[model samples]
Target: MPNVVEPKLIAGNANQPLASAITRRMSIHRGVHIDLVDARVERFNDGEIFVEVFENVRGEDMFIIQSTSNPANDNLMELLIMADALRRSSASRVTAVIPYFGYARQDRRTKPRTPITAKLVANMLVESGISRVLTMDLHAAQIQGFFDIPVDNLYASPIFALDIREKFKDRMDEIMVVSPDVGGVARARELAKRINAPLSIVDKRREKPGEVAEMTVIGEVKDKICVMIDDMCDTAGTLCKAAELLLDYGAKEVHAYVTHGVLSGPAVERISNSVLKNLVITDTIAAPEPVKGCEQIRILPTAPLFAQAILNIWNGTSVSSLFETSTMEPIYEGVFRS
Candidate 1:
């Protein structure tokens, strides 16, 4: 057998908790002690970001764990700087483990003279000397093609499927998975198939960014509990509107399972007053105080899933097999229960 190369994990300020969790799971799964790099990220008086990697990463396989979420520009710049620092330090390879790839929604141009910011970000990473990228549940699947390096797009469907099975085990017959919009029908349909539930779609019109117009429920949701699925919930406008429409259509209850809970603007307030029973989201983007304090929200940790993917990548194993939800066991039960 060839020698196994252990990866050096580095954490950025984007989401420290998630980075820590992933580090812990990696150490446990490998049965070997692994530590995150003592990297410091701070800003000078003029607000210029500074990054310093304290450990020697020369000839090492390094993975920088950072999610370009809220304060997207700051976190994104931090990632680029860190990658540059690692590359200059003589690291053999640098893999960016961005759990939540921001600016992914702007993958294409809707109007003339517009920019494809997603592709731009990809170019920036490549120019910064990143060898590969590992991200999850991109807003648009085609965004992977924007990257010149090897990109591994992980899915949150298996994670969500496990939770749905456990939560609605007894009432699976009365459950129906719904797509908040036509674009998310494929995602919702996959979840519905996993749990053996009927699928529904919400036909809605979006006049502009962050605004939803008239919405129409296309399937039979009357008397059935609905599970609305989407890639992300930004302002909650579309989610709230779809929930109200579902309730008006005589749906017994509505719940949501979204990958990224951007929850910007009045999202928390809207969810608090919305007709949904619960809004379940992964810890891709750290939940703010309002989202944490909200009684209607539940957070699921994606660290274990990410940890397994990283391990598979390091071992030259198949990463797609990690999507086998039925065969996989949950590792972060305490965090989810809490």
Candidate 2:
């Protein structure tokens, strides 16, 4: 909290509770003369999005909190409009604090005639007057290059590591950390090293979207408790399929730790019906109703980590130290259903 400038924070409709939580950790409260420029969004009969911000924001350091989650286009548009409004109102600077940056997976052209949607989103933000962006665990680390402005890509690993230590204390040898896809091996490997466990990979091939066939396992997983780790879980296709495959490969139990829970389409039903014992996701995006009701799924808040990061940035302190390997003893054993 050193040299704090008391930057003005604003919230959008995407995930107000998360915004409020982050604010509380930063010692800012609601209704403390905070101005909310009304984002009057209306949908036309044709299902189009319209947005208007109704407050004058002259010379303020504006931080707009909006996550590009479900209805990705609408939420994205809302953030853009809010930035435009603040820009025209003479706001000194505008920072878009999007915890769950949507369209991040489309970081590059995997096939012919495919658009790099992540770059497009970055361009849109820049065009809409966003001076900077603060987000976490992007689908691809290289996506940061898409933005010309300063983009702070925070890590939820510290938060996830803390929870893991508390949940799996001893019997670490019985556990194996898994990356559901080859692209995520680094992420899973890091978590595995932190927990003093072996790393495993699910070598799967996708024939098309939302369909995966697990071909092989890359590590020793027989009769061991497995924990799959990923940046996000959207349709639950990859995670669920990996879990089932792990079980078939003699994994005693399977759990997954994903940062963003986009839980779109039949994701909830898929996870519920899969072989997963538990699915832990961070509150980057507000989880939908069916996802919340799923018995095997649990949500942990990331407000503390983000709040601390904000404080560090405001005070010109280093946040890289937060990712240091944990020295604490482990906490849970065996796979947990919740």
Candidate 3:
């Protein structure tokens, strides 16, 4: 084989628990041992970010696990700075594992004079000496093109499929996947196919960002257990509205599987009062106290998936297999994107 550097995991202030979990998962593998870098990523008195990596990273393979979630600017800066620090420390290679890539929704120019902030962030990362990127469930699939370095875009579908199979195994006959809006039809469609469930679309018009003017159910959800799917949840206005619409249309029960729970503003309150029976989200974005306390919301783990991906990256093996949900007869087929 070829040479491979000792891989190290570096945690930023973005999400410490996730970084630790990723490290812990990888440690259980036989013949492999990866530990968190002995580093300090802190804020200075003037609110400036400072990074100090105590360990000698010379020629070491590095992976920085940071989610550019809330406090978006701060988290983004921390990632950039950390990558720069690792690069200066002479790390052989640096990969940023950003679970929730912020500014992703701003991928394109929505209007005249508008900035493509996603591309700008990508440019910043490239300039920061980041050699690779691994992120999950980007708001816009095309955003991957913004990066000059190799990008590995992972999905939560496989994990979601397993949970759905277990939760509604007995009610598969009535399961129906509903996209919160027209844009998320593809995601919901894949999940629907995975579970062999019917698909529905919520036809809604957005007058402005975070404000839904109207909502209409586009398919038969009557008496069916509706499961809504989306990439992220910010204010929960559209989600709440769609759930109410489904309930009004005679659906049996409404559930949601959102990847990034950017539950800002009254999102928690809205979910609490909405007709959604349950809201299942991933740990891509760390859940706050209110969100953690919400009875209707549940958080899932993405560490094992990411750990395997990291190992594949380090070993120069195929990472795509980790995405194969129930793709062939060792299980089911077409459950996850091939």
What's each prediction's TM-score?
0.96, 0.88, 0.94
lDDT for predicted candidate 1 compared with the true structure: 0.90
lDDT of prediction 2: 0.80
Give the runs in model 3 whose Cα sits over 4 Å from its true position: 1-5, 31-33, 327-338
Comparison by TM-score, 1 against 2, better one: 1
lDDT of 3: 0.89
Per-residue lDDT value at 146 in model 2: 99
Candidate 1 stretches with Cα past 4 Å from truth are: 1-5, 330-338
Residue-wise C-alpha lDDT for candidate 2, range 1-338, written one tens digit per residue: 68434666677779988887777766742224333445566667997666666665677667888899987888898888878878887988898889999999899899999999999999999999999888989999999899999888877665666667667766666888999889999998888777788889999887887777446788888999998999998789888878888988999999999999988888899988988999999989987778789999999887766666665655557766555644111211222223
Candidate 1 lDDT by residue in tens digits, 147-206: 989999988888888887778878889999999889998889888888888999999887
Best by TM-score: 1
Candidate number achieving the greatest lDDT relative to the actual structure: 1
Go through the candidates in order and give each one's C-alpha lDDT.
0.90, 0.80, 0.89
